[model samples]
Target: MYSKKVVIRYTATNVDQPIICQLVKKHDLDFNILKAQILPRREGVIVVELSGSKENFDKGIRFLKEKGLTVEPVSKNVSQNNDKCVHCGACTAFCPTDALYLERQSMKVLFDAEKCNGCELCVLACPPRAMEVNIF
Candidate 1:
């Protein structure tokens, strides 16, 4: 079996809740929240990582776009600046995929794109807008 991974990002305002829920239900797709920083601020980005059959993946993308979600291909390049970071853990805490982590000794933030769902929660939480999503 072959599978493809797609990431979707969107603000709370753009989200179509019912459509998202319905797609999840109908496709039996695995949805993982990569970030949720915008929840508290009433505006945030959601990153969902979906892996399934190619056909289902395509359908899922269409469904998300129709629902008003910004869907895009995940990119490896991430805009992160550790110098400006304060190690507040906001990004780590908000990461739904456990992709961001803090080193035990240095307390530095790290990112794993493979595990990232491309949700922009970290982007929304960063005070300096350090985290950037590269949609291809």
Candidate 2:
């Protein structure tokens, strides 16, 4: 099985559609909603961790595009600027994936890149602007 982290953005017109549901029922993909801002009758975004076979994953993404949803892959270029970071643990509080964590022994901020889904919440939560995301 393969897994992908992706961001889906849709306008108010598409808000009520069962686009994500179709991925599971029709394409046999499993999706976990990581973060969502599905405001009623407003443009919103959702971050999901989708897991399935390669073919099912591709087909599900294609279906989303066909339904006029803007599907973008989670950028793999999320990083923390260690030099600028103070290790205050602020970002860790908002990290849904536990990508940012404080070491138990040292209390230092540690970033695990592989676990990061690039939801970008840490970027907003960081006080010193230490967490950064670059599309790649």
Candidate 3:
């Protein structure tokens, strides 16, 4: 099966739609939602790993775009600049994978690259802009 991690951005009007559900029912795809934040009348974002035949995967992505959703490959890399990090732990709360965590005794934040799914939430939550997403 073909599989890839992707990020989907939803506009206010499309935030409530069951678009991902249709990917499974209509396109015969399997998906694992890594992270999501959906709210009524507000923009939404979801990070998911979709699996299916190559043709079906292409079709599913096309379907998303047609529905006015923006779909892009999840960043290939997420990194933290230790020099810039104050270790405030803001990113730990938003990280779905626990890739960012605090060393309680030292109160220092640490990152485990292997645990990261590249959801980009940490990048958004980091107060010092220490978290960085690298598409390349």
Candidate 4:
């Protein structure tokens, strides 16, 4: 089995659609929704970790694309702008995945992109506008 994290974005038109459900029932994909903002009759977004055999994973991706859903890998992630950063820990507070952390002795910020869940909390929480999300 294999797994990959990805983000899915869809407009209000797709809010009532059960695309994710179809991916599981029809394509035999296992999905873990890490973060979601699904409002009624509005734009919806979900960050998920998809797991399955290689063939099932590919089929699941194709199904999402065919349904007009924007599917992107989570490689595009949060990054700190060194010039604007103050080494403060504000952004770290909102980071649910521990992607951003503070160095104990140095009192500096540290980031691990691989652990990122693409929650986008750090972008809004950054006081110095140092944290930015790189969307694909």
Top TM-score prediction, candidate number? 4
lDDT of 4 by residue, 14-86 (tens): 8789999999999888889887888888888888999999999999999998888888876566687888999
Q: Lowest lDDT 10-mer window, candidate 4?
A: 127-136
lDDT of 3 by residue, 14-132 (tens): 99899899878989999998778787889988888999999999999999999999998775457889899999889989998898999899889999887887678888898889999
User: Candidate 1 lDDT, tens digit per residue, 1-136?
Assistant: 3343445555666543555678878776767655443454244455556666767777878887877776655545455676676767789889888888988988778877778755567889888767886543
Candidates 1 and 4 compared by TM-score, better number: 4
- The parts of candidate 4 lying over 4 Å away from their true place are 84-136
TM-scores, one per candidate: 0.47, 0.62, 0.60, 0.63
Runs in model 2 lying further than 4 Å from the true structure:
76-129, 133-136
How many clashing residue pairs appear in each of the predictions shown? 3, 0, 0, 0
lDDT of each: 0.66, 0.87, 0.87, 0.84
Candidate 4 TM-score over all chains jointly: 0.63
Report the backbone clash tally of model 4.
Answer: 0
Residue lDDT tens for model 2, 1-95: 99988888888999888889877899999999877888788887888899999999999999998988999877566888989999999998899
RMSD of each: 8.7, 6.6, 8.2, 5.8
lDDT of model 3 at residue 58?
98
Clashes by residue pair, model 1: 34-96, 38-44, 47-119
